[model samples]
Target: LAKTTQPISMDSYEGQEVNITCSHNNIATNDYITWYQQFPSQGPRFIIQGYKTKVTNEVASLFIPADRKSSTLSLPRVSLSDTAVYYCLVGDGTPSSNTGKLIFGQGTTLQVKP
Candidate 1:
């Protein structure tokens, strides 16, 4: 299994953009890099996913390199409301991945100020 590592925290002002990168060195062949954003009291929401190259959605963009060892999440024009904790998780499974167990890291706390 691949374990993810990200920043413990980040600070940015309102109206500025933010980008959070995660590193996973032991990623599996069937694993796909996935990012999730969380608010103060809400569950983590899926941001984006990618195997390689680039993938974008309404909220964020996911950029994966060829080696599949690292990935970046780009958030455009962030605001104060965007302040929250972000988590980077690798491994894609239907009901579960391999043994049906997921190990999440401490998570990166994003602080957006005015």
Candidate 2:
């Protein structure tokens, strides 16, 4: 399985832009970079996904460089409610990739203050 390395924790304030970077040097060509956000007691919610270049949505944007070895999740104008555990997952997102499953790496705890 591919692995990602990210900061253990980060601090931000309201109305700030927070960028979280994840490193996956062993990423495969078929693998995709995905970002998920998990609240204290709930399951992780999909934030964004990208195979290459940049992908953006209402909530976040995912940036993947040309080499695909690392990615950055950009959260614009983050608020206190945005505080959560952010995870960077690298996989093919297909049944064949992991024999019918996707493996997630440990997450980065982000603290949003007022």
Candidate 3:
């Protein structure tokens, strides 16, 4: 497993775009990168996942460079409701793997103000 590093916290106003980056210097070839957002007392919600290149969904966009050492999660026009802790996870999430276990680090706390 590769360890990840992220900023302690970030602040943004409503309707502004926010990008949170995570670094995984020792990522393995078979590992997949995933991002999750968690609110107070709530379970982590899956935001996005990618192995290489860029992946986007209705909520966020994930940018992974060619080196695969880091990734960025882009949230467009964030609002106060988006304030939460964002986590970057790295592992083989394939069903065949059958691990069903996930490890998370102290995530980046995103504070969205009005």
Candidate 4:
């Protein structure tokens, strides 16, 4: 239960302000880095999480930099219905012990061009 590398596509316009970056780098030690938001048929939710520094809510901001591999998901001032698809999960611990979870490892298509 350790795999994460976000961003598959990104293009902003509506209000401009979107950042999505992730790289787990074999991150372990009860891994904890979660960020999800998929709005195309609805599913992903949880927006922020970290085990280092910086972690905002209200729907964005999470910068974990302390050798925690890598993580950054900040989407402020974005529009066009926030064009969806952004997932990065590196084991957020306890899903009844992994629980066959990979939290999806093929998504990040956010094209809000207008």
Clashes of each: 0, 0, 0, 0
Overall lDDT per candidate, in order of appearance: 0.85, 0.90, 0.94, 0.81
Model 1 lowest lDDT segment of ten: 93-102
In model 4, what lDDT does residue 26 have? Answer: 78
Report the C-alpha lDDT of model 2 over 1-104, residue by residue, as the tens digit.
Answer: 78899999999999999999999999877888889999988999999999999999999988999999999999999999999999999887554556634677
- Regions of model 3 farther than 4 Å from truth: 93-101
RMSD of 1: 2.2
Candidate 4 structure quality by residue, lDDT tens digits, 1-114 = 667877689889987779888888878766788787878777788777787778888878988888889888888888898898988888756645756366679878998988
Q: Is candidate 1 or candidate 4 better by lDDT?
A: 1
* Two-way lDDT contest, 1 vs 2, winner: 2
- For 47-111, candidate 3 gives per-residue lDDT tens digits of 99999999999999999999999999999999999999999999885566777456799999999
Q: Tell me each candidate's TM-score.
A: 0.90, 0.93, 0.93, 0.33
TM-score of 4: 0.33
Candidate 1, residue 64: the lDDT equals: 91
C-alpha root-mean-square deviation, candidate 4:
10.5
User: Which candidate has the top score in lDDT?
Assistant: 3
Instruction: In candidate 1, list every pair of residues with a backbone clash.
Output: none
Give the higher-lDDT candidate: 2 or 3.
Answer: 3
Please write out the lDDT profile of model 1 over residues 67-99, one tens digit for every residue.
Answer: 889898889999888888988888766435356
